[model samples]
Target: MRDFTVPAEAGLRDAGLGAGTTIALPSGRIAYAERGAGPPVVFVHGLLVNANLWRNVVPTVADAGFRCIAPDWPLGAHQVPMPAEADLTPYGVADLIAEFLDELDLTDVTVVANDTGGALTQILMANHPQRLGRVVLTPCDAFEAFFPEPYTPLPKLVRLPGASWLASRLLRLPVVRRRPWAFGWLAKHGIPGEILDSYLSPIHDSREIRRDARRFIAGVDKKYTLGAAESLTGFRKPVLLVRAADDRIFPAQLFERLSAILPDARLITVADCWSFVPEDQPGELARLIVDFATDRRADVVEEEHGC
Candidate 1:
C-alpha cells in the first residue's frame, strides 16, 4: 500500500486536475486522482485516455461531498506500463477494476464510466458487483459494437505488427487528432492542446505503453460485452445510462436497449454533447451523477431530454 501524491497546485495544472496519486497493484502501479471526501465514486475511462478525462467532472462531484477516484487504467494512455505477464483482456481489465476497489477497501462505491470504460464496467457488474453501489454509463461501446463501426478498423490495425505504434505517432499531430473520424466527433468542443498532449504522450514516447495499447486493442470485440450482458440481470444496483445525444460513434438506440435489459436501469439523454460527455457537458453530467449517488434523482435525472 503506497501513495504517490502530487501537489494539486503544481502537478496537474495543465489538465486542471486534482492531487495525482499512484497505488501499487498486483499487475503494476495504477495512477489516479482523488479529491474531497465522503462516499466513494470511482471513474473509469476507455483506451488512449487517462484519469484526466474526469478533470472537469471530478471537482464538481468531489465538492458535492463525494470522494472521487479516477484511475488511469492501462488502456493505452496510462503512464505506467503493466507487467509483461499482465492480462490485458477485457475481462482482465474488469478484474483489475475490482482489484482496485478491493485494494482501496472501498465498498458500496458508485462506478462511473465512459467509452470503453463503460464496456469494462458491464463486465465488472456481471462478475464483481459486490463492492459496487451503483453504476452510471455514458455513451460507449455496446452489444457487438466494440470499437463501434467507424473505428472498427482499430482491432484489425492492431493485429498488424507496428501498425498501432505508427497510428499513435500520428495522433501527436494536432490536425490528425481533431479530424472527425478521430476525436473531432467525440466532443462538441476540442480538448485543450496541453491536455490532449498528456493523453497521447505515453503511447507516443514509450514502446511499453504502446504495447499495452496494442494488447488492449487486439482484445477489443463485442463478445466480451455480449457475455457480460448475459449476467447484468443479476446486478440489481441502481443504474443510469447518460447517453450523448449527438455522438456519431455510439448509437443512441443502444441506451434505449440497455434501459430494457437491466432491471434497475433508466436512460437519460444529454443534449449538445457527443461521446465525451465529461468534456462536453461536465457540469450537467456531474449534476446527474451527484443526484443519482445521493438518491435525489427527481430533478436532475428527470430533466433529461429525448435522444
Candidate 2:
C-alpha cells in the first residue's frame, strides 16, 4: 500500500484535523485524521469522497471537547487502498468499521455519518452496536433507496469492465463532474475546487483505488439496507435523524420512517442544503452533533447518580 501524507492544500489544517494516521485492520491499512480529547466521535463519509467531507465540521466539534476521528474509508477517493483480498461489500465494509472501533478500544462512540456512509453506519448499528453510544445520520441511503434514483445504475455500471476507469477519466472534466448526476446534487453552493480535487484525485490516479471502488460498488444491494431497517427497532440507543430540507435525493419520508422505527430516535430538518449536509451547513451540523452527544452523556451521568 502507498503511504500518503496529508496534503497541505486539502484544508485539513484549517479544519484542525492535522496530519493523517494509519491503522492496521483485518482488511488492510486505513488512513484517518483526528483531533481533540474527550468523548469520541467518528465521522464516516460516502463514495468518491474521503474524510475531507467533514473538514468544515471537525474543528468546531473538536473544540467542543470531543475527539473527532475521520477515516478515509476505501470508497474510491481514499488515499490508501485495501488489500487485494479485502472484502469491499456493504456487509464487509460495515464489519471493517466495527473492527476499527474495536481496534481503537473506543467505547460509547458517537458515530456521525453522511451519504453512503450512512447506509454503512446503519449496517454497523445493526450488526455491531456494542461500542456505539449514539448516532447522527444525515441525508443518505436507507430502506429500498440504497443508491437512490439517478444513482441506482451505479452498481451495475461499475460491474462493466473498464467502467471504473472511464468514470475516473470522465470525472476529471469540470463540466462532467458538476453535472447533477455527479457531485452537483450533493451540495447546494458547490464544493471548492481544491476540496473536490482531493475527493476525485485518488480514483483518477490509482488503479488499485478504482479496483476497490468497483468491488464496493458492484457489491451494493438494497437488501443490506432493508435488513438493517428491519433491525433498527432493536437499536435502542439514541439516534438523531437529520434531513436536508431541500434535499433532492433522499426524501423526507425516509427520515420520518426512521424516526418511527428507532426506539429512541428524533428527527430534525435543516434548511438550505442538499444531500451533503456537512458541506452546506457544517456549523449547524456540528452544533447539533455536539449537543446530541454531550446532552446524552449528561443524561447518562444523571441516571448514574440517581438524579
Candidate 3:
C-alpha cells in the first residue's frame, strides 16, 4: 500500500483471479483478490492479519471447485498510526466489513474466517442473510478475550499513552519475534512461502503495526459485544467450527456457546495448532468444508477431489 496503486488486476495478482480488485466502501477501502473458476468462497482474517491469512487454503478450496475472494480491511490489529490514539472499535470494524459485503453484492458466498474475521463474519450473518451460503469459523475471537492470557498485555499496553512506540519495541522481543515463525509453521500445513509472505507482508515495523492491534482490542466491545452481540439471536446459518484445540486466545467454551446458539453448527478441533486453523489443519479444514457444504457427504470430499 506504499504506492496505493494496486498491484494490477485490481489486486488480483494471481492468474485466473481478480488480482487488484478494490471494492470501495463508505468507510475506507477493501482490497481484495479472487481466484479460480468455481463457486465463490470469501475469506476474512483476524485483527492484525490481512486477508492473506487465507492464502494457504485458497488454492485447495479452488482446487475443490470453488472460487476464492480474500479481502483486506483497514486499520488491522497491526496497523500502527503515528498519532497512536486511533479509536479502533469492533463495531466500527464490523460496520466497515458489513458495508464492504453489501457494496460488493456478493450473495450466496461461502465464508472462511479466522480471528477477527470470525467475529465479523458472524456480524455478516446477523446483519446480512441472503449473501451467506456456508460459514467456517476457525480459531475465533468473537467474544471477550485478551483479558487473562499472555496477550492481555496487548490491550493494557495499547491503551496507554504513546503506547504505539512501546508496542513497536516490545514486539521485537524474542517472544514476539517468534510470532512470524509460528505463523510460518502454521501455514506450513498447506501453503508455500510465497503465499505465506502475503500473510506477513502487511507490516514492516511495530509502529506501523501497533495501532491496528490496539484498535482491534478496543473495538471489540463496540463491534461484537454491544452491537453484534444481541444480533446473534436465532441465527440459522450453517456454520462449521474449525477450532484449534490448544488455542488460548479463544477457548473451547466460546465454541461451545456458538454451537449451542447457532441453529446449524458443528465443531472440529484441530490439534497441534494455535488460533490459526487454516494454517494448522488445511487438509482437515478443507475436508470439513467440503463435507459441511455437501451436507456431511464425507465420501464426496475424498471421491470428488481425491485430495
Candidate 4:
C-alpha cells in the first residue's frame, strides 16, 4: 500500500473524495480515493468509466459516517494502466477486486457497484464473499444479457484490427460520443462535459490504456455472469438491488431474477433515471446505501446479542 497524488480534476475535487491512494496488487497498482471513517464502503464502476462515476454519491455516503473508497478500476477510463502480462479478463478482474480487498484488509465491507461493475461484483460475491458483508447492485449486466443488446457486438468488434484505436478516436468527437450508441444512453440526463472527458481521455490519449481496454472488451463473455448467477443462491449475505425505472440498457427483469436467486436480497426501483443511477439519482442512491448499511449492521448486532 502506498499514498500518492492524482492530478486533481475539477470533477473529483468537486466530489470531495480527498487525497488519492494507490494499492499495489498482484496485477498492478490501483488508484483510489477515500473519504470519511468507520465501516468500509467500496465503490466499483463499470467499463469505460472510472471512480468519478461515484463523484456525486460518495460525499453523502462518506458524510453519513462510512469510509467510502472509490477505486479507478482498470476498465479503460483509469489513469494507471495494468502490466502487459496482466490478465484483464472478467474472471481475472474479479480476482483483482478480491485482491484489492485483501491488500487493504477491508473486512465486512459493503460493496456498491453499477453497470459492468455490478456484474463483476456478482462474480466477487460468488467467488470472494468472505470480505463482503453486503452489496448494493444498481443497473448492470447479468444473465445472458452480458453486454446486452446493441452493445453485444463490442467483444467481437474490439477483436478486429485497429478497432480499439478507431473507436477511441471516434469517441473523442463530442457528437459521436453523445450519440445514442455511445455514452448518450447510459445517463438519462447526460453527463457533464468535463466529467465525460475525464472518463474518455485515458483511452483516447494512451496506447497502453487502449490496449488494456481492448483486452477487457475482447474478453467479455456471459459465462462469468451466468456462473455467478448460478452461485448467488448460496450467498447468504444481504444484497440490495437498485433498479432504474427507465433503464434503457439493462432490463428491469434482471433485478427481478436476481431477487429470486439470492437467499437474502431486496429490490427497489428508482424513477426518472437510466442505467447510471449515481449520476441520475445520487442523493437517493447515497441515502439508500447509508440506510442499508446502517440497518444491516444493527440487525447483525441484535442477532449477536440474541435480541
Which sequence of candidate numbers ranks them by TM-score, best first? 4, 2, 1, 3
Over the stretch 1-307, how does candidate 1's per-residue lDDT look in tens digits? Answer: 7677753322533344567777888877788877889889999998788888888999889999999988889998887789988989999899999999999999879999999999999999999999998999999887888878778888888899879778888998988998875688888877888778778888888899999989988888899998988898788889999988888889988888778889999799999999999999999999999999988333334657432
Provide the TM-score for each candidate, comma-separated. 0.93, 0.96, 0.75, 0.97
Report the error of model 4 at residue 296, Å: 0.5
For model 4, how big is the CA root-mean-square deviation?
1.5
For all candidates in order, the CA lDDT equals 0.86, 0.91, 0.61, 0.91
Higher TM-score: candidate 3 or 4?
4
Clashing pairs in 2: none
Please report the TM-score between candidate 2 and the true structure: 0.96
| lDDT for model 2 | 0.91
lDDT tens digits, residue span 1-307, model 2 = 3245664434532355646777888889888888998999999999999888898899999999999999889988887789999999999999999999998999999999999999999999999999999999999999999989889999999988899999999998999988888998899988998888888888998999999999999999999999999999999999999999999889899999889999999899999999999999999999999999999999999999999
**Best TM-score among the predictions, by candidate number:** 4
The true-versus-predicted C-alpha distance at residue 159 of model 4, in Å, is 1.1
The candidate with the higher TM-score, 2 or 4, is 4
Which ranges of candidate 1 are over 4 A from the true structure? 5-16, 296-307
Q: After the best TM-score superposition of candidate 4, give how far the Cα of residue 145 lies from its true spot, in angstroms.
A: 0.8
By lDDT, the better pick of 2 and 3 is 2
